[model samples]
Target: MSSTPSASLFKPLQEGDPGDVGGYRLAAVLGTGGMGKVYLSYTPGGRPIALKVIRPEFSEDPEFRRRFKQEVQAAQRVQGLYTAPVIDFDTDGAQPWLATAYVPGPSLAHAVAQHGGLPLRSVLLLTVGVAEALTVIHGAGIVHRDLKPANVLLASDGPRVIDFGIARAADTTALTGTGVSVGTPAFMAPEQASAGTVTPATDVFALGQIAAFAAIGSPAYGEGSSHAVLYRIVHEDPDLSRLPTELLPMVTRCLSREPADRPSLTEIIGLCHELSPTALHQGEDWLPQTVADSITERLRLPGPARTPQPMPTVAPTPTEVSPSTPPPGTVDPYAPTGLATPSAPGAPGPVRPRAPEPPAPGHHTATPGYPANHTPPPVTHQPSAPQVRQKSRRTGLIVAASVVGTLVVLGVIGSLLSDGGGKEENKGAGAPATSSGPTGGDGGAGAGQQRKDPKPVSYQGIDLTDGYQLMLADNPPRPVQSEDAAYDGGDLYFKVVNFLDESSIGTDNGKLVLLDNARKGSLETCRTETRYTEKIDLDQLTQGSQICVLSDAGHVAVATYRGRSSESDPGSYVTLDLQIWRNAQETDGN
Candidate 1:
């Protein structure tokens, strides 16, 4: 670790940075970027580390979150001589974060700015160390699209590469399309600028750029706007005039315009040995005398360099659960790519189909929840005032018809009496019937046969598809097309822009969840003509939250999530409970 005092290494925590993230107590700002913020924190053992918390905007992006989760999972395989490996990460949180072992050192950018270009010996050692880092990164099937002075750390022990294995290889791809490539223009290889195929060679090109920067204390492509720098990288040759004669040939080969022509990492390491001494190793003084002296001086000083740790109970670990059990039906987090794919923009929605008969309540489906033996009940939304009003109206109509029938029967009996009990024809026509089978004239329509199930003003609906089933990625909001649908039916066809994190709720971070109800199904089948998206705050919900999706045929599709099917790694996608309400009137004004 660099001996730099905490004061020099960290800045005071600002308003936006959280007091704590996951289980780590953030102490100071290590660095900030457009994508995320890196904070200085420590573990339970008092070991200092760097914690990177993704910005909320990016965290809300389903696509970005999915890719980031995969990258973090893959990153665990890397353990390199000169790379700061990620120690842990939370894929199911509102603010996704990852912690890496801290290397107490200044960034190469800072190092070069403070002490001028690294000496020839230091440059060779730095190049070799970073090359070894790349080999490990590539072994994990990752390419570091961004490699520059800021990413290279001049640790007292050796140079450690930071922020590796986060970007992807293809997009519409020349490196720019993947949404993962955030490469700096000056250091970006020509192919990256042109969106060419990114491979391990792409990283080698970046390494060459870093080496040139360290040699001359400036960029190989010189300085200008990002566009100008990128233009130079693609159209003009590198101005390696400031690079020393000894290291020129190797770094030049690394900067080859064609990725196929660039030297491999192993070849670059070999060339480093041929050009400069390789005696440098961990704990050896490899930095320039001034830089080394500055770092060594801090080791002799004493101050409160480490921040204090949080109490044991402040931020609970994932393995632990809250005291009160969540009402049964709490389910796994939302899967962005299940059956809920968003339709193409401006495409008309499909016509509504006659909804199939849904299974009775208490029948568990294969969603992310508890084991089959512990199938949780479906969540029901509270009956609203309008629903009550509709029920009353129907009751009044039935009562009025019953009164008229009773009066007519009495009048017939009176007429029989008036005729001195001799009117046998009228008696047979109004004769009461005996039940041979059931009520309503021998099974014409029994009470049991009559649909007694209450209209579902609000209830949980689940899609029981298996996790491996493929689905759509996104669907824009659309309007309901039912001619008899409510005036504000379009409002019911809401498009869920962002949702609250519903992953095993009770976290301070996620109090609300947004859902897309209208656009559902895979590529071929979609429930298009409906407008209804919902936002539910998990913290606020005493029971399961209600997600009311308006249907095309003047109805509402209400769904509520419950417990998981099995705790074992709940498969690749997420599950939901869905129930469609026909002739829905509760949300008419809305």
Candidate 2:
């Protein structure tokens, strides 16, 4: 057994200030915690170091002292350049003190506090560096069960992961019962909280939470008491709505409740690498407001340095309201759907008038609602009664022929087709040439009668619903809701849902795809699957109002078109909404 240690024999080597320990002079106090007080120390050559002196009470615990010694030894084994190098230690002294390379920089927590939030670019940088650091730390067979904002340091070189004091070595024997909680409650994964096994997945989960914090300026799980936060982490859904559109999916995958669902550190590093090379730098640019604020606040907490300045807050612009039609001379009106909208309200509404109805079935007809007898007065009052009589006779002939022709042809084609055909050639204006050609196997005749650039599809104008206008070629009737059906060029699918609701459409085992102009393929070739649930509201019977394309697996996708108009300009064109989901119904309960 290791002998109990004495606390008083550790006296200052030099009388005046014991200015130097092991040839290193103490400079200033860095911080104090349960184990010891950390001091900024320097060597004779002016190299800086952090020297930690153990507390008297902890010195009495032989087991804890042994663990601390082991910690020092384990830390020495970490070969990564991101970690501070352990230079020397004197465990036999009355009060043991250890020195490590002084990593001069701000903690991740502090940086976030000073800055309102890290931008997307900066977040990418922070993510890459931290992920690389974690990879290196784990490679050394150490589990950093206490990874959090405070444990990370932002040095001039790159982001450095530090504080391996409480880290446990893998393959070591377990001395404590399972489910015993350790480390900061906020950053701990569910498995960690239950004293479950720690693996690379745990670190990935923590990194995901960290990335989320960097992106949204708050934890995916909101602020609350320690118990509530921990419970939420273990059981609740991570609110990823605020994450940037490009990064949301990746972050969501990381926060999955199941350990297996979370990604590996290598995968996490790859994602970070994909985001940006600069992210591998020391100063992570994407610091969240909470993190920035926290860091800023901590820096102000009686530090040797003066408080840093706070970052400016910039309000985002609002999303533009979509219009019914694109102005003349444009290819299509609603082009950019599924875009991240701005938060500004009081935005000007779209002002363009609806486009002229295409000569198709369901086209709104003026004759049904307006009388033909409402004639325009001549520029000058004509005295000749014969001239008026002749005009009336011609009108009567035109009207009579149109009625007879439509009646004769009505039996040959379906009602939907006749309605569209009638509009193409009205009242003896001329005979509408009906085309005979092979359709794309879709039953409808409209499949082959489409214009080269078909008109944009409009929604039934459902107010307060997350509806959007859509645009597709009038090629064939696309499959809207079937287990395994292919989409055609003209058909548009649409649905309205909130963020969480959108995230949950089927069996908690689903994926959502928001199709917009960002997609590379033509609308007809874009094939995907989706899942559904009762609360998901995938009513397939609705007309062109809000078409829902659903699969038996509980997947869904919606399509919509939106435009903009102004007095000074024709305005812009973009697709307002398009959502697709694979079965994720189980996620709803959470």
Candidate 3:
């Protein structure tokens, strides 16, 4: 056995320890297990990696070796942001070892033991991270056999799950003996002890135990011998009364003994956001609504009715004004600066006002030279013919000059407008004819232009028929209305857009998205619409055609090889033609 380090210790691996195993040079012993030891190691190029070596006794068993190989295969299927990735492995070597990406952090057990349990926020953080990891693993058709505090590590970014040695492939294949547990006894669910098969729900039970420990510094089944704890887990009700009210539902759902009774990883993620501060900070609280209907539909469990509260409305009050206020007017300093009133016929005279003064809140006062209620005296005069005739001559000259300038400007404007209009009409004329042009355009004018542009006509919402969408390769074609609409099983739909300017879908990159629109109606509304993408394998892109497909709710996706390009334009077509049924029908509408 290897010497153990203190629970709180976190050290980088060094060189010349074990030299190299699975392409990683051993640096320091990170932790030891019952059947293997994990070392901090680095690649020849200086990349950090976690290298694990199987115990000599375990390695001697061919059956164990076979299982280890299968586990490696199962781990490869999982792809997620939260889980640690398996980087390399050598199960056939003298000392079978598996190397995974080295994640820096303390195990949940160590973190809790050193820091003393956790606060509500940390517990929430751990909940969402672990749940997210479980979602990905379950999606890949794998079940984590053991999910205890020791198996979860608390990293700077988030929590991560480790130890896939005991994980099982989720299928008809049975991997262990009957009536004997294959996982940790303390964290095992009741069905696990009493002929219960391994499933995603079994991991849920263990997560409940870990969450309870994080909250109250103890397991929900109480501290006792493994047999006693197993018996209680099988028979007793989980004591979640001490849990925070917001987390009670999550813990309760996880602790359910019946596999079918437990909530899914997707539902758990939604709950974690609701109850955990970390999930709220990440803005993932709306993930639960996507599967709430599915959970409700599949389980058909009746929940307590909740009373709805009325919304409050506030009215804006308008400001009041007083009478005696002058009507609103504009004062243009550039205008002629005098004011005068017409003289009344045979009775009064004109009134002349000085510069207009600003008004008080409720009153207006006349200016210094203006009379408020009387008219001013009028004057009468006549001019001689020489002045009137000169004025007429100047007016005629000004009119002629202005008309010449106006005509010149209008002529230029009309010419420009006509040119622009003709261009637009010509542009409009080309589109209809091009689209309706013979399909046999020799791949030059019509079909050739289309292949070059491939302008997406519309976003046909993800096709989920027969799961055909799931089988679509990376370069999935936009579904054509007339041709090959027939769907096989395993299709999923994804919403993709051509942000041609922002992204490289056409020239460099193709993007995939999963939308969370926020909780609405009686169910949960999506919170945000977001995209999650990873770089595609260059070899996969060049050697063959591939398309990326995501199911409508963004819960599932698959990558497939469509075919290679025959034409010069490097456009690949991804098609969703799988027929899907009941559980997979959570399209965008509902």
Candidate 4:
């Protein structure tokens, strides 16, 4: 296995991101999720670690903090060959963070996406490693509530399970209140989906899903929205017909709906051993050539520098001034500009006179536009008589009317310029103005702009076959051959084989959320909805069925199924109208 460190694995810390936390200097951003960011850092002795900083909302809760401390202690005790152990942590701080031994390899999800499903032997070996890791984890009285493919790192030595006991701590937090599920939708156990008791068996169910995903390149329960997947896990049986014959019996037993019916970790390890007697002896050759090469590339990347980069500082916005407050670029004559010097220890300090009292409400002591050293003359009672007050009121009304008149003229001129400029710009760009339903191509100008509803973009006549995969993230979305280099980054794949007339659309790096009866203007619904899945079966939909696809590039696209090309051959070809909202988060008008 290559031990080279690749720099491409790390992204530079962004502005306002802390350069260092505790004593460890952050090298770069490892990744980010809803929980918080993970940074690549090194110990004082130079050993690399993945430091995960909890988000403020989670860390600020006293209940979460107390649970976090307990979990960190249990996680530190977890020591196994296939698990990344927590080495250091600080739960007492304002933002609690924990450091784990960094595993220099792509996640199982990334590896499978880059290279197709793993060979049968490789899957068997992966099962053995993960099962053993679970044995050690369960022995330490910790249940890995969430054990999806992304949490498993494929190292040269073997698979290393990460985020083991962390999920338990998060489950107790207010973020995951009562009756809410904590794990990923596709891999969640029946009990977890229904918010029932979770045990080590819950991890076993997820492990089975991971194994099936590695061998079949998609989840067994079939995916769409989180609700759909969770409903199927709780009510419907998993479609394991596509699973390899050698691994069928084991995976079936592991995915049993009832927790008690699921096989124990020891039984799972034994089952894997039966499938591949020499699984332990596969060594570095266990992974396929493509996956092995990916791991080698990741290991060869150079580690980040130890020195911390300076954090960028943003100038504070100027405060709005009221009648009593001093305006910007001007100083108050009555306010002190310098501070008194500190006196020597135990020495008598000079007696300083008290400052003047503040002006009463609705009164101004300092004159406008005055210099720092300029002091205004003392007020006289002669100017405050009733006749003088009337004159001042009339002057104020005149100034206010003049200001309003100037603003009205400026508004008219600005509106005219904006309309003319917008028309000319759109004409030069050759973009459409009126909404003519969904049409594809960056969703035009108004697609992701703030405060305006995104225009729907359509993609018609899309064909889905066995060897060709759909690339939703690409401009002018199209399909490419399974063996094509584009397939590595492709979002969805359709598989059709004999005996298993199953046809499904599955993604590796993106999510597909089903919207049952949505129309053309479903972009806003897609952007706001949170439930997402990796794949969805064609049999579950009908004509005019809408599906929202959150692309790998963070673009929200709505895929409206426009029926199949041929009724006899449903999987041969299908039509879809897409409305892609780019920069999905910006559509919220933040």
Candidate 5:
């Protein structure tokens, strides 16, 4: 290891800080975040590690500890070439902490802030590494909800994604409050901004934002107050004007408003591959030279120096005596003792033992005979014979249950097949004696005719600007200005010019119907016959009210009114959660 310390990379420990924790000596404070502080330390074998110690407030909370323990266990199972795997953790301690292999490099955020944006080639390579890391992370059933530039580190090998699932454990706690979002506002996906369901796709949206940030040196949505940025993310499209030409398409697809519209991690890797075939193997030159130099400087930092505690001497007992033993405090002349024998008159007659030195405050004393850097092996408990037998019995019961469940499933399938056979025979015999149900096919089996309705596409928290019309028939619906929304230009129009009294949703050429009792309406509820009108006043409708519409293009849509976009700014327009069924005529037989 290189022994050149860079003062910039470390800060001296403050007063009252522990010198040693769980056998790892704290060299310096690496960094601090909202949740806790990170320290640079070394393992028993002299391997460097980044140890994260939880803050007292978070550790003391019972709920945080419970969630933290679960997250730690799951994190330990995450193993990826582009990730720093958890090597050790202590969740049940007063202050829960975990250790991971130290990455001697600056974070992407710091690198970019110190230097400018990276070159196109370096950004492509960074994408490949992070995408690969996400693949491994999601495979382990964990989402890296916080994938900002700060959570990505630039090393000589490649980019490493850190702080994977830790954000989730801190989410919805008293510290953050219930229903509050848990990610950086600049990089948050639209769904996250609206309190919608978050999934793996949420990370993909953040990934796109990261790429834009790396190539353009600023956030996709211009930086400002959190509220303003979130509003843009939910209502406005990202400003990709400054992004590199080659990266625009991939980034755009990843930033699609609907979660279903974003590309998968696999697709992202393929796009990176197309841009640079050898992106993953760029090695030390993957980062720009200036950033690479920073990594070099960090690698040269020296390890923490630990003072070895002196071992106490004990008189030999009769059971430990042997023929080769020397007299107390006297060295055998023929033996090659490393120490010099006391022969001078003024020399001490017998070497007097000194009391062991007390360890520094907040520091644990080193164990006798072991080096200061040595860490004892962890203790493990083995199951007893009785416990093993009990486990075997439980396994047998589980196996028996599985067999019974399989038989039940098979029987159900056989019965369904039998019923289907009877129906086919009746059709062949031309038997048509059945009571009529609903007027249309309605995705039901009617008189031996089997029909299925197309699945409705759902979009949540879609904002419609005042005076602009929304095109619900579009694959992923979009908004169009009123002038462009002529005859068949759009589906629903937001009329906010007359305030709450006259503000309503109306189709210029089609029709609208209010579904009073169907607040939780779906495609089935929309199929029932109801009076259709050109417009429905907003003043009479409350939040959570449902409106079914037949667009000018002949497509059917169910819109749930989600109230105005901003309560403080009444002119900001309203929000709607929508579900649209395309080609409605085929199902309705109109």
Candidate 6:
């Protein structure tokens, strides 16, 4: 193990950080170490993941990568509550990185610091959860070298074991130098600090220390420098005096100086269940009430405040005539439904005003508690009265011109017949006087209707619930092989995407899309078989809302993770409340 100090916690990537680590987009720096930097990244499906990127100098060592690869294989076999299972890794990269499922909760260390020591009941629940997690870890023949508060997460259902960056199998080539220690000194077991042979018992010791920290808000051995803490762990007894009296005995046994003297994981789990009968599980309150409230606020999705505006329209051209029983211009305010005829000029025709058309039967004004009114308003071009008259006069001129032209044509025919010595009058009379069928009194526009352009269809955002986390990729979802197509579009509109089948969605699939200007822009036309990416935008979050997104097997989700914007970096950042999605009901969504 390297000797550098642990200088950071999960933080945003600093300058010089790689945008892409091992092809995964590095989103944030999870923590920093002497040997490497842990990054927060995601798989192709938009699933957030934690990546531990080993330092360059270490990656240069072939033996190190080989051992790293071997441990990765071993850790893969471990699956349990509380443990973050390894999903992928690259042991041979220039700077190797390991990726694991990104847990959605905060670390135990953060929890204790924020909320103080957990309540007794909560401590018991944590014990059961962590012990169950440890059982799985030990069962895989791996000893978690660093089982500290920072490595335990308080998930909705239970505690999740994470950060196995220093975990090693019971029987493997020790990856570190021959006589070096390889874990946090405060939580390290006696054997680890002394560079002695370690067994599963070493993890039990660390677990005890974690429990003590969670209970008393401090390490069992108390705080000190690395050397002092290590000396205390190896030579002195754990100061469990601060732990609750009832819990002292069990904690002491787990912290036994002799590894063989410690209680087995099975026995520890039994004690935990006996102490807290209602163990944490699905659909239960695993965290304290306040913490849960904070979590809920964080994941609440604020409804967008602004609705889409209607498109601007130009007034329609005026009609010339109307089919009416009344004399010229005596028709109702509007022309008769089908026909358009010139209206009388000079405004003396006083037709009584009609009632408001009874609001089209069911159409009500925007009054609250009124019965439903589904009828829409009439589409009115509403041409001005003077403009209407001008159009009517123009229509009359066209009609007069047409009539003159027809008479001239008829006269010409009669003259031709007379010259040929035929019955000219008969020839002229026999010819039908049909005038090319201009309807009586109606101008160019008649009962024949014109179609109007259709209105736009738009979508809205929703608040997300538990069991889901989502983040819109900084890069819009587009075809993997397609040439990069980037553009600066205005405000976003969101849509939930449903994958056709479970297998259809993966790391590279299930992205949400936001179609800009739905009225003018085209909706995506990807194949029905599967879709992974869509250009989506989340800007203009309802100024005060916390937004979250979730990607389950075949469902896309979004939720509120926090209630307020970050105090330190107000508009500059928004943290997405993310969680791994699973199951068919996720398709239905909450």
Per-model clash counts, in order, read: 34, 58, 48, 12, 0, 31
lDDT of 4 by residue, 363-445 (tens): 11222333211233544534221211233477898999999999999988886575674455545455545442332334444
Off by over 4 Å in 4: 1-8, 177-182, 277-279, 301-590
Residues 453-571 of candidate 5: C-alpha lDDT, one tens digit per residue: 55677665555656767666543344444665343455788866544356767888567779876356666666674788887887768888888877655478888888874432213
Best lDDT among the predictions, by candidate number? 5
Residue 254 local lDDT, model 4? 91
Pick the TM-score winner. 5
Off by over 4 Å in 1: 1-8, 169-181, 277-283, 293-590
C-alpha RMSD (angstroms) for model 6: 25.3
- On the 0 to 100 scale, the lDDT of residue 540 in model 6 is 32
Candidate 6 local lDDT, 1-590, one digit each (tens): 22221223334445477655555555456667645777765555555667777766566666665556545644655667678876666554466667777776767887888888887777877887788887776654456677888788777778888755354422243445543334567988898789755677888888888788888988889887888988998898888777987678789999998988999888987877676646544445767886665444322211111113322133334454332223343433432132112121111122222222222111112112211111123335454233224554778989999999999999888866655644443346565432212112212322232222122221121122111122232111111111122211211122223263111111223444322222221211211213234332334333323222223333233323233223221011222322222221123232
The C-alpha RMSD of each candidate to the native structure, in angstroms, is 21.1, 30.1, 29.7, 25.1, 22.2, 25.3
lDDT of 2 by residue, 89-116 (tens): 6554556667777665667666666564
TM-score of each: 0.51, 0.43, 0.45, 0.51, 0.54, 0.47
What local distance difference test score does each model get?
Answer: 0.57, 0.49, 0.49, 0.67, 0.71, 0.51
Model 6, residue 410: displacement in angstroms? 78
Could you tell me the lDDT of residue 102 within candidate 6? Answer: 70
lDDT of 3 at 586: 34
Model with the higher lDDT, candidate 3 or 6:
6
TM-score of predicted model 4?
A: 0.51
Candidate 1 to truth, TM? 0.51
N/CA/C clash count, model 5 = 0
